[model samples]
Target: MTRHYLRNASIDQPLNVLVATPAGGTGQGGIDRIMAALKAELERRPNGVIARFAPTRGKGALALSLFHLTHFCARIAAWRLQRRLDLVHINLSSRGSTYRKIVIAACARMMRVPYVIHLHGSEFRSFWSNSSPIVDRSIHALFEKASRIIVLGTPWQAFIAERVPNAHGRIVIVPNAVEEPRVAHVGGGASVHILFLGRISDRKGVPHLVKALARMKDVPGWRATLAGDGAVDDLKSEITALGLADRVTVPGWLGPEETARLLATGDILTLPSHAENLPMSIIEAMASGLGVVATPVGAVEDIVKDGKTGLLVPPGDDSALADALSRLVQDGELRQRLGAAAQAFQRRHLSIGPYADRICAVWQDAAAAHRGEASLPALVTPTDLKA
Candidate 1:
């Protein structure tokens, strides 16, 4: 299905692009933001670059087996399509298979197309270290061969530089961007409505939030909304077990409009994720003028100024999470001040336009480098074609 889209995309002259991801057309969260920013640039500039989305097919009953198989197949299919693409961009995650990485990197080299790899986490310490030594070495080799690498934070930039010294110059920091809030300012009140809006997985620290809510339920009118789906039964059971059913609402799997509406109603946003690589939800909340309470992870520190734009707590520390939430829930003045600062910060730095421009620049640089090496026939620019 996606291959046909790529073939049709090739017919256009600007620059035919392919976005290989596990996410199909749904475009939720960070993936959605990326696709939207890229599409906007392609539409406005008519860069002939049409991004085609492809989802990897998983196999096996076990979660690990399914993950491995899906990554392997996705890479193989992407490797085959490298010949047709002028440049290939890979979104690297912690869960990818080593075999798939080798195959995909080899294909990029064989096709002689410049490939850009985007790093989204501190996956090296969390997942890769636990895997076999051979797998670790293979993953290192994959990072070394990339034409360019994209990172969201200084920590990742330093991590990649220290570990993969040779590839230091190729690393580009392009933080995730968020769309500006659309609705009227729907914040500032006594009864603070907090939200945790993402996958309810262990890594996300959903259980931690539940426990914190259980402790703080005695605070008058303190409520929370968990607006996503993942381990739904487990989360629900935990909430029930903790006696937080009245305080924390699990309204599962909200669509964009619903999600945005819920966010607008929220007085504050909190995400106590164990790990992250610049969560878009936090940025969206900031854009919506809501104070944030999150664990210091990924590019969060870059946006959130502790006690100013938002409050930061240590990851997995349920006590600190509860403390931060309680502080905001009790002080209306503090919440409004943080919310305003967050809104201003997001408007100044995290808007989608700048993100679009940066990504387009990266793509153009990669495309230009590929063209220079290949010495392909000069093609007309979009403006030239129009003329």
Candidate 2:
């Protein structure tokens, strides 16, 4: 389908966009943070876009979660009846998230409202490949119903294109972004501080991170903080067993303000995950001008260029992780160089300013496509918009 671009569309009123996600701003997950950041950025701009946070899933019992999902579907019907809804932005993940979104998308379609699906699940491929044929068809039908399918990276774009061949033309790459850190980056005084901000689980390679840090016990000038929830007790036990009890601290979880403070004070941000969909921690670290040491999983390599913006170690490689950490801790100049480059890359591409513009364009374009007004809006670059 050829998408028409409307050069001058009347935009006196803001677009009412219903964004369905796990938990908008209050949730601790990466997708929640992304939507929260986007919502906040959109609020800051008078760009004629109003996003309503319609949280479909929450950190509650199964019954409560189901209630929220049902409520979200009903709310969509109600909003459409009131003629207040312009588009439904469905933030989807793997497994249960996909199931919930299928129902939500179906409801939105029944109400004749266009919806976009933003894929954020890291283990989606594994989940989708293992699903039954009936489930696969339902998933395919969900994609077929979407106005657009937003992916975090190019690899994901390919993945979705291969799975839903007909929806290939609708796939778009919109990497996770963060607002410029309000707190400035400052070195961790004498001993370099390494920060790990995510779930404290095996998928995140936290065990490997502890083992790597243990190898650096003989080396000095480094302290680590693994600040996140999940398997916290297990991680603590491992840290003690590795004799890194004194050097490594396992704080359960940090809120946004605390996270910002930690990001500002830390010298290096590390996430040795086995899988990811462009982890947001790296983006936040880059925005804070912290040297990043992460595994090249999913779309990590898209922004974290090895030896340039950040160092990439193979997944589950304790030795390489230790080597990367030791290198950054020992060489302050290298840290500064990498941190500066990462920060520059973030400002140019991953900052919330341009991110908000691109998202707004997608929402506008999706809305237009639903109304059969014209083709997708011309996605203007930041420079192009300024000009």
Which is the leading candidate under TM-score? Answer: 2
Rate residue 259 of model 1 by lDDT.
Answer: 77
| Alpha-carbon lDDT, every model | 0.70, 0.85
Worst 10 residues of 1 by lDDT: 378-387
After TM-score superposition, the amount by which residue 113's alpha carbon in candidate 2 deviates from its true location, in angstroms, is 1.0
**Model 1: lDDT of residue 24:** 37
For this target, which candidate reaches the highest lDDT against the unseen true structure? Answer: 2
What TM-score does candidate 1 reach?
0.81
Candidate 2 lDDT by residue in tens digits, 1-387: 112222225565678989998975554688888888888876775677778896788767766889899889998999889989989999989988999998998899899999999899998988889999999998989888899888888778889899989988777788788987868877688899999999998999988988899889999889999999999998888888888899999989888888998998899999999999989889999998899999998888888889899999999999999999999999999999999999888888887777777777778878877777675534722222110
Model 1 lDDT per residue over 102-188, tens place:
555666677566677777644445676686888778778888887677888777777788878998877777777766665665753
Error of 1 at 88 (Å): 0.8
What CA root-mean-square deviation does each model show from the true structure?
7.3, 3.6
